[model samples]
Target chain A: MSRLSDLGEFGLIAHLEKILPGGVSKEWSVAIGDDCAVRRSSGGRSEFLTQDLLFEGVHFLPGNSKHWETVGWKALAVNLSDIAAMGGEPVGAVIGLGLPKRAKLREVEALYRGLARAARRFSCPVVGGDTNRSRGGWTLAVTVLGETRRRPLLRSGARPGDSLWVTGELGGASLAWRAERKGKKIPAAMRRRLLLPTPRLEWGGHLAAFGEVGAAIDLSDGLAGDLGHVARASRVGFDVDLETLPRPRGFAGLCERVGVDALEAMLEGGEDYELLFTLRAGAEKAFGDYARSRGLKVARIGRARRGSGIRWFENGREIPRRFGGYRHF
Target chain B: MSRLSDLGEFGLIAHLEKILPGGVSKEWSVAIGDDCAVRRSSGGRSEFLTQDLLFEGVHFLPGNSKHWETVGWKALAVNLSDIAAMGGEPVGAVIGLGLPKRAKLREVEALYRGLARAARRFSCPVVGGDTNRSRGGWTLAVTVLGETRRRPLLRSGARPGDSLWVTGELGGASLAWRAERKGKKIPAAMRRRLLLPTPRLEWGGHLAAFGEVGAAIDLSDGLAGDLGHVARASRVGFDVDLETLPRPRGFAGLCERVGVDALEAMLEGGEDYELLFTLRAGAEKAFGDYARSRGLKVARIGRARRGSGIRWFENGREIPRRFGGYRHF
Candidate 1:
């Protein structure tokens, strides 16, 4: 029998999907394969549901490597990112926690404090959940429920003429990850960006309600892989200009210090948790102004074109798709 | 600092609750501390959400001991039971899975087949979820979304005069568990009761719509523990008649074979997935008749009183509470 490592994460998902009974319900607006499952609720509104699981060793390490609080924050933040990707207002979340038998009460408390911090910051309360003893390692599974007044943003909504835009800069998470690996102290700002990613709730809500953005997805699996998802779903091609991609402050210096290519980090690093989307023509200036007003960064880096596959250009030369970002397996 | 086992499961939940902000929302009809969290969705309908997690070694043992298919069935069935407790129709579900690196693709397929079985039986489609690599054992976390047109049955709604009723038999799961512990082959029927519990969705819906059952909960954490939850939530006392408790066919023989007490199994055994509910006085006959017509067993075993604490009785004598049931910590 083929092992899970051989199938890889995405391959396993596809295999499981084929064996599962129901695909999409007629009552649901969107189902499996989206950032969030969307169903029409009572008040002519759309309800979105998403779930994510984070496992120790696979997602993060305990001990001095990472704080339990930061682990908890990222656990919930990933789910919140799914809701934000759909332009939905998160209402509540249920967390299913599996802790090792030897876990300390203080560590659990610290984790809850981190979860509470994120909950309050996003106004999405931690409502209810289940907890159990784990004979193995710790695991945190978070499920978030949200609602949208308008139609939810979908990765399949991008059109050929739409310009691709991204929120915030990339490579900071990669920098922090490298720093942690090298036993070097990471800057607080970089660590926060890596550990406690802020889901663009307000920005996504505004875009869904007023902005002319078409398709949207969260950058949890780096720009290349996530953009590939949008491209595949929308059945369109993308031409991204590497020069136009936004970089964090001191990004070049950080990459140089780590002996890595800055452009590679921006393209292939995961856990950025920024929003990647497509905008209508002539809407870039307005969107940029809105981001400036809100103290958020918006970068226009690519455009959807009539065709298939993602092509990259760095200073007028096509860059081959060498890597497809992070893979869990 | 104290360890998690020092606090125990319930105590840890209470501790976490105190530190977490935003307990209840005005917009939510029901928040935490229930079988499921409920909120009013658009179009005058109530939406219910509940989550559960199952961990290997903690909840089950894979490989030669237990079938992965049965594990998948129980994982989804537990969540379905929560929806039944709320008297709601399950709309969809999201499952977050964590698998060890050595997991086989065939085993994963078997697990999905079991999940598909339950989903088809309950009409709750597997809509969306996330999967990741696990450094430890496997974990399955499921979140179910459901809707109810009528008022949801809450654990806090039982009145002073309500009669407690349970659908289906108990003790079968305990018998199966004992058999497994003894390394003896469990009866196929008993094994099915333990591993593939049927959620009482129809009965719960009927009770919610017409039978006047007030408070309801699914039997997961034994009769003693779950009934205590109802008593505490409703602020009422319960008087349970031990003699009136329903037992599975050949339950006495199985208990005798396993060298266990049948009564203890009935009171302290868990994973029954039976619906434990309270009906208004005079509604028993109608409810019983409805259940009979539907070929289901309904046992009236107790009553709610105007006080706190859960008390047991046997033949006009009070039976002191011996054990408080299973603790995760």
Candidate 2:
């Protein structure tokens, strides 16, 4: 709890190093002891960079019974998904934190513990950062450095004949939030599904090297919303087969409990943290085979069309998108 | 005016791009159109990096007349000082802003304009950024990147015999802040001193190439406070000659209006953004010559000692540090 200036630049940094579970690796040629950090990419590997900001209240409410560690985990997980979307492996991350002066020392430490856990899990270093006192709420800004060997997958270049696919079913996070709010005693298995998301990085990297995917995106904003992004970015439309859409097991009953259609969940409920990608029509079999070998479920949901806009088909009936996904503005 | 999510990612980004002034140059490799921005770095040239955060209430008051542009400039200025300490030239910067949802659009746009002006003046690009809604107060976090060819300076390199020196005068910001509060008008030149901080980046960079300075720091946290940082970091003590400290021509008169000690103001008031450094005793003449030629006044304010702790001497009489400095927490 020392004042930033009083601790002095060096003392402040040393204090931060002590709090970290383990130190950054030797890849950091110029680390915390210097004016700035310096690290060379693993001998000519291209650098992959992405940043995310988590503002208190907007990202998470302080009163939520959900633990801070989980918040830390999901924050990093979501950004990692962005790198995964690029078919890259995470190397390290720098965190910039703004906390109100009144914030508890214990809470701050816990937040870093969560950050450290995520770093260790992803095998990325919690490299360097800035910790400042805020006038109001806490804010976390993270910039991740990732590495790619083959090539980076971008959101452009989807062909009209390419097939679009998604990994895992969506809507679990929305349902989890509701359940948490209602204090529903859901089973540990489903609760974990809602809380801890799996980043499809490994699958995406292999898909990139396999030369099968033309464009890729992560389902951070649900299928309908993020698919729209890829389609727009690629200047193509999509025709999704409703019947082909994957559903969560026992999803129908869960939809009934919520008084809504299960299709809505699959299309628009976000925080899935799953990868959505497009592949050449002829590459589906091999792609599917590779995914299954990795124990991941690949759902062929739609096809890229020459036109703009998305349409859904089910049992010979075509339907329009009732809901796309969440928006922040 | 737009629910951020409603704006959608592309639409929101376009809005930002349109509102922000066009880039001064092509330093940004990927710019705003990609999944992540790519930049020129040390692989090309040694890069300087620093991130700073300013929270509402702590840094500024609600309904304060200070425009968002000032806040934006201040954020960039503070980080610029860090790079300046390392004697690096500004290249580009990224701003991650979090605002209370209720903030006006004009305020946000002004913030960008302020950022744009700073970028143009410093010859740094507004490469990229992240924006989100804060649960409560508005927060502005800026990460600045700079470049240098010389060995980066650090706070731990000062030797016991090194003479301590400071560029320009200190404590002008505290005087300006006090003047603004008392409803007293300061002269336009003095006002500019408070509103626009002069970053000694080029000066520091030149100093670094000369390679005579032992250790260095920027005076963003007032002189005593920031000097204390260097003292502790170097594990050495310093004695400051207060009589040699340059006084802003207009500052001595403010003691009466603000009911504060001018000396104390010079000691603890911050945001001067001046470089404070230590150099080997024999290099004093060269340092003085260089400083004089550049129209920059340099003074031999102290000496680094074998032990730790900072002491101030006025008329060669040792004086106690009445106050440390302004600290956020």
Candidate 3:
């Protein structure tokens, strides 16, 4: 007799995990709980499968062509991030789009064009889909299929003494949200970071190729929450050095001007779509060299340790905190 | 500048086909414009992928636990039918579900249970999925992955001399719709057929094993409209013998009471989920014997010929027709 609101998002997932049959099969190595389900394919490769859903009002604002296009990009980008988290290469995607009766064909086409553009960028084709008329707002459900020749990265591989690293800057999504809420126009760079996140596919694939990186996750649910998932799955904890964390240009000033806490925004902001992975201790120098060689910026922001939850420190002083990032419900 | 309503569902699909890259690859034998996208997997087998979407208030009524359960079942069932249409055995499925905030936990559990039941019945596991909260009604998008050792069937395989056959009676879905529209109580049998259709998986697999069946399509868009797809794809026409079509018990009487044309209902009502396939000339007797051994009911309802579109006849006399079946937009 309980309502969905009471269970929250993670609770609901846990409930489903209990009720449904074991998500794994003979060919599948990982299933429901992972970022992407992994299935053993031929040629020493494993396939990754992930799905994501975005609703009109819930996920995006219904507007002109640009808005629809951005929605389309995000719908596929999020699922691609799942594959990236698994250190997989793109194969293809299927989009299930639901449009209201009054939807314009041009807008719908623009959406498809946006999806096609992203597919081409990642070398993944739009293979097939289903389109239907809806009695509600527009819904875009995208499922991406990917493959990896190397062993797939997983959240459960993190261990105590592993160095935590992240790609790109954080807090861009939160800064954009705060700017919009305060009636301030978002900066062009920040807006792009917020709305058009580039999945770190190459970086993730490189991590897998290195064979020394312990575990990885995408920063979709903010650093604290997502790292918490890695911590729980790997039965470890994290100690983040606040000062070492990379920030978007003018991040602190923008947060202060918008009347938000800069450090909190960086730690708890969601949808950054950056890679948060752990490398074995002493492997940092070599990994940093590799990152620089690839022209990718990576920062060692924290370290995994023997504990239960994330512990934060600013200049070696423990900072007591609360705020577990975004929850959909 | 056209609205979606102007182009309709098929028109939108045609538009997408032109704008996107050729939905094919070195490993993919078929992609867009087929029951399932076929990818050459390992072990001399090819994989089939298909997706389907169902929206609340458009495809079903949102009510109590039973209604949610039925919706979940139909969501996966329709995708299975697509795999069945390709004459493939399902390997697994992924579901994307969007629920309104008010959706009950108990009901969602019931829905998942129903999905699990169907998955067990067909031996297709629910391997993965994404669930999100929506700003609108419930939405279910399901993608099924299947595989076949035999060559997958295609609509373009129909030849001029093929015999058209259908498994199960027609008009049940149309009758259910009519009865509901007229505020009349729908008979239990008709309602079950409409909502909980049994995909003709065994029959489709058998046809593919026979290696002589030409084209095949699931009866989701009614016989006439779906047959039109095969006709266009194979460059062959059809002459349907209306008298030979098997009707649900009391179909005509129910249609008459609801003020609907029985013939139109039988030819144009959608969601039957029956197998409509073409067989090579003079193979009916052998196929019939196989069907009898398997306890499957099938009837020869038409003949493929060298023409352009479907021509309907009643008792060898042409019956002029206008209805072209269901279009979502």
Candidate 4:
């Protein structure tokens, strides 16, 4: 008889994983507790199924039409990140919209306009949806179907001694959030990154095609939290060198000006939408070659080890664990 | 510049259909404005995708744990009915859940238990989903994927002079709704029908296999309003004999006791989840034979005509058109 607030986000998911059935059935390769569920029908390629819900006021404000458009882009982009985490290309998407009675018709249209923009960019068709009147703020749920010929990446694939790496940089979204809360001006680049994240679909596809990449996850839960997922799934521990972690330009300076701890932001901030993955031992050179050839900037920041949870280190000194990432509950 | 309240539900959908792109694409046979979006991929059978959103207060009240469980069942069942409307078998489903901060852990678990029950009943696997915190009431969005080897039924397939038919009795849900609104005790059977509807998956599959059913739609929006959808989509009209409409046992008596118009409830009350379809000319007998063999109770109620809108009649007298069905807005 506990409240959901006590269980928190991951706790609720854990409960669902136990109560729900049909994990890896005959037609499914994977089910719950992953970036996307993998279904493999006979004579057909494996498909990925993922869904994300965004609530107004919780996820975004019911602002102007322009802001609503960006919210729409972000709603679909987050689900696309899940597809990218699985190294699959999106096939189609269906959206479920719950709008309050007072919402404007133009705002709904603008939301779709943003959704259409992302769909076109990712080559995923907006297939169908259901709309209903809500007693609350706006609710947008997008479910994307993805397909892949290669073996889709999973968080359980990482082994001890694997090198941990991340694409692009971290802490931008978190920084923007902290700055906005403190009534400080957010950096324009960080604000854009927060509003409209570019899913690393190409990089994920390349990693899957390389065939030697280990566990992978999108950085929606920041480095410390996402690595914990990989660690638990892969039964391995991570030793991250905080100094080697990639950060957005002037991220530390901006955090200092806003009186927010940059290290805490980089480790626990959510919604970065960057890919964090591991490479098998001795495949680093080959992986680096492929990444460079594709003009992808990736940084090796840590190594998986024979332990549990994440052990953060800075300049060979162990840092005490503090942040627990972002949780909705 | 108008509000969504002004345009209403269907009007917003029509606006979206025009604004959104990639309808009937190379890999998609149907997109929007149908029971489900049909996807025809190479080397794979056609797949249907649909989504539905249910909000607390709008769709249901957040009562006890048992009520939450029924809410979960209805959320998935409605999506299953969409697949049933298309004559397709559900492959898998992904749900997006938005829970208020004060929601209970047991309530969420109970909700999943109900979802598990419906998923097991239909053999549609609940694969993956996203859970988020809401600033308002609970929001459940479900997207189901369905597969069909036979040609899926469409609302636009009915021709002039085709016989319209419906599976099972109607007005049970609508009657219960009226009873609840009037603070009257509803019949147990009617209450159950409103809470947990059985999607006619097998009957729909049979209709698709028969390949002679003209058009199909699930009676979610009541008899008269759903007919309007088929009429507009197929570019035909309907002539329904109100006397021939099937009703639950004591439906009229209950409506009369509750001070509700029986005819209006039968025509415009929603959430029936029954299959409303048309039989091709000369296929009625064969269809009846199949339905009888399957222990299905079906009745012929009307005919599609070469005109616009619906014309109701009883015993050679035309009834005035009044009810427009249940609308959220």
Candidate whose lDDT is highest: 4
Q: What DockQ does candidate 1 have relative to the true complex?
A: 0.78
Query: Which candidate do you rate higher for TM-score, 2 or 3?
Result: 3
Tens-digit lDDT track for model 2 on B251-274?
Answer: 777766677688877888887888
Select the stronger candidate by lDDT from 1 and 4. 4
Q: Write the per-residue lDDT of candidate 4 for residues B1-329, one digit (tens) a residue.
A: 67777777888888887777766798888888889999886555789999998888888788888998899899999999999999999999998889887787888888999999999999998998989888989889899999888888999999997999998999999899888877999878899999999999988988888888999999998988898999999999889989999999988788889998888888888889999999888888888898898787899998998989999989868988666977877
Per-prediction DockQ scores? Answer: 0.78, 0.13, 0.71, 0.76
How would you order the candidates by DockQ, starting with the best? Answer: 1, 4, 3, 2
Tens-digit per-residue lDDT, A1-329, candidate 2? 33433443234335434422222344332232211223335445544556667887777656432376677677777778877887888755556777664565446555655666676677655544566666667788876666576656767758899998887777666666666776665556556766677677887787777787888888876788888777776889988888887767776786677555677667777877788889998998888788878776788888998988787888767875566776555
Model 2, runs deviating above 4 Å: A1-49, A63-66, A100-102, A147-150, A258-260, A289-297, B1-48, B62-66, B290-297
What clash pairs does model 4 have?
none
Give Cα distance to truth, residue A164, candidate 2, Å.
Answer: 1.2
lDDT of 3 by residue, A51-96 (tens): 8888888888788998778877878888899899989998888888
* Segments in model 3 whose C-alpha atoms lie over 4 Å from true places: B183-187, B253-260
Q: lDDT per residue, candidate 1, B1-329, as tens digits?
A: 66677788888888898878866877677777899999876667888889998888888788632388888888998999999998999999999988887777888888888898899989998989988888888889999999898889999989999999898898889888888888877689888988888888887887787648889999998888899999999999999988899987777887888888887787788888888999998888787777777776789999999989887888879966575777776
**Candidate 4 overall lDDT versus native:** 0.88
Cα displacement (angstroms), candidate 1, residue A258, comes to: 2.6
Candidate 4, which segments miss by more than 4 Å at Cα? none
Best by TM-score: 4
- Evaluated on chain B only, candidate 2 has a TM-score of 0.83
Per model, kept true contacts as a fraction are 0.87, 0.25, 0.71, 0.85
Models ranked on lDDT: 4, 1, 3, 2
